[model samples]
Structure formats: structure tokens, C-alpha cells
Target: MPRRSGGLRSGTHYKLRIKSRDKGAHNIAKQLQDFKKEDIVMIRTIANCHSGMPNSRFLGKQGKIVGKKGRCYAVSVLDGSKAKIVVAHPVHLQKLGGLAVQISKTNEGVV
Candidate 1:
């Protein structure tokens, strides 16, 4: 037997399937959503679209938008003790709240 090796979405058949209730035409609003630098966003993979899709490991992880590359946005996420950047489309990202407050609070006690 041989071990398998591949990038992010190597074995995500069931993990990224769309539910019945969510089955329908894609939302134009979501496809056209815009994100600014420093915005906190949660990665939500769109199963059908693979262009600019981040790794499945990063799915549901919150990251800060750093900049834009072509039509995709560069996002910085903390993976374990290291920081990593991934390029993803807006359709796979959902805005999240309270990140600024949380960051500030975490920094307050640090000398």
C-alpha cells in the first residue's frame, strides 16, 4: 500500500457537500461581496467553485484580510503557533464581528 499526498482538498468528499436546503442558484450578492484590508473573515468553502479556494484545513478558520491579488484576497491565519497566508475568493469568506475587540483585549495585559 502507498500513502497518499496532495494539497488541501485531497479527501473532502463528504466534508464539502452542499445540503438540500442550501441547494439552489448561487447568490449573486455573495459572489460580489467585497472585503477590505484588516477585515476579519471566516472561511466558508463553496463546494462547486475551486478557483482561489483555500485549503480545507483553513475552512471555518477566522483570518484577517491583508490585500487583494487579482480577484482573490490575501488572508493571514494563525495555524498552530505559526502564521500563514492564503489567497481566497470573497465567496468563500464571510465577515465576522468582534475581532478587533478581542485582539485589543488580548493585547491589553501584555507588557
Candidate 2:
């Protein structure tokens, strides 16, 4: 497949550092640390997909979000096929906890 202008590279997308979600002089950082071990999360899409699929599809897949090279979430979207997707950050995704896939990532605001 050809490289899309904004598409992510396989290896380049797997070197991101997880952001610190903490409160000064508190144990909140420890709680946030546990979230990283989660295998899957529910999130929504903040970017436009040129694929022409419905918006629900992006939010409905059980993709793996890993901290990649660019500090992007290497999302493995499972829509009939497995796509190694990369999002700029994980915080962009809204954690649904149980059975709701509605993660959202910011494509313009942050780097």
C-alpha cells in the first residue's frame, strides 16, 4: 500500500511516552500508572478518515493502543481486517470502562 500524506509508519509509530496524569503531592500518578496496562480502551475519533467508513466504525473497534515511537497510540483497529493505526496520544481517547467504544483523539491541537 502507498503512503498516505498523514498515514503512520509501522515502526515509527511505536515510541511514545505516556503522559503524566498527576496531582502535585498526591497519589494520583500511581493510579494513572495502572491504566497503561489495560489491553483495550473505548475511544472516539478526532481525525477525518479518508476511508469513507461510518464514524461509528472507528469508535466500535477493539484496537490496541500502545505508546509508539512518536508518542502516538499505535491502535490496532479490527474492522474485518487488522489495521495498525497510530494516534498522537492516548489521553485523546475517552475511557469508556466497560462496553462502550467512544475514544476520541485530537489531530490538530497537540503535536
Candidate 3:
């Protein structure tokens, strides 16, 4: 017998399931969203969309838009003390307007 290896989507059953009411075609508007650098965005997995989805660990985390890679945006998120860049599609991200946005605005001149 061999030990099983876990893959990216192996344990993401609950983290990536779509709701009953929202299980149809994906919204085009979401796919067309644009994020400028410093904008804060929340990572939300849309189970139906796997093309440009980020890792499951990044789900529910907020990150700042650093740049764009191909059709996805590079989001800078702090995992513990280290910062990691997560490239994700716009459909899996929801723009947030709150203290996170203010923090990014204030730190604009620091870096």
C-alpha cells in the first residue's frame, strides 16, 4: 500500500462549493472587473470557476492589488509574517472598501 498525496483541490470540498441559487452561468461583469494597484480585494472562490482561481488557503483573505499577470491580478497578502503574491481571476475577488483600503492608501508613500 502507498500513502496518498494531497493535491491542491483535494480537501477543498467545502471551501469551493457553489450555492444552490447561484449555480448557473458566471456573471460577465465580474469577469470584467479591473483593480488598480493599492486597491484591496477579498478572495472568494467560485466553485464553478477553476480557470484562474487561487489556492484554497487564500480563500477569505484580503490582499492588495500589486499588479497584473496575463488576465489575472497579482494580490499581495500577508501569510503570518511573510507576504505572498496570489494571482487570481477577477471573478474570484470582491472589491472591498474599508479600513484595508485606508491602510493601503496611507502606506502608498512608504514603499
TM-scores of the models, in the order given: 0.82, 0.36, 0.88
lDDT of 2 by residue, 4-33 (tens): 574342333323222355223433332232
- lDDT, candidate 1, 17-104, per-residue tens: 9998878787889889998887878889988777788889888887778899998999888787577898998889998877653873
lDDT of 3 at 107: 64
lDDT value, candidate 2, whole model:
0.40
Off by over 4 Å in 1: 2-8, 99-111
User: What local lDDT does model 3 show for residue 49?
Assistant: 87
Clashing pairs in model 3, backbone N/Cα/C closer than 3 A: none
Candidates, ranked, TM-score: 3, 1, 2
TM-score of 3: 0.88
Worst 10 residues of 1 by lDDT: 102-111
Candidate 3 residue-wise lDDT at 88: 97
Q: Please identify model 2 stretches exceeding 4 Å from their true place.
A: 1-38, 47-57, 99-111
Angstrom error of the Cα, residue 56, model 1: value is 0.6
Q: Name model 3 segments beyond 4 Å from true.
A: 103-111
Q: Would you list the C-alpha lDDT of every candidate in the order shown?
A: 0.81, 0.40, 0.87
Candidate 1 TM-score, true structure as reference: 0.82
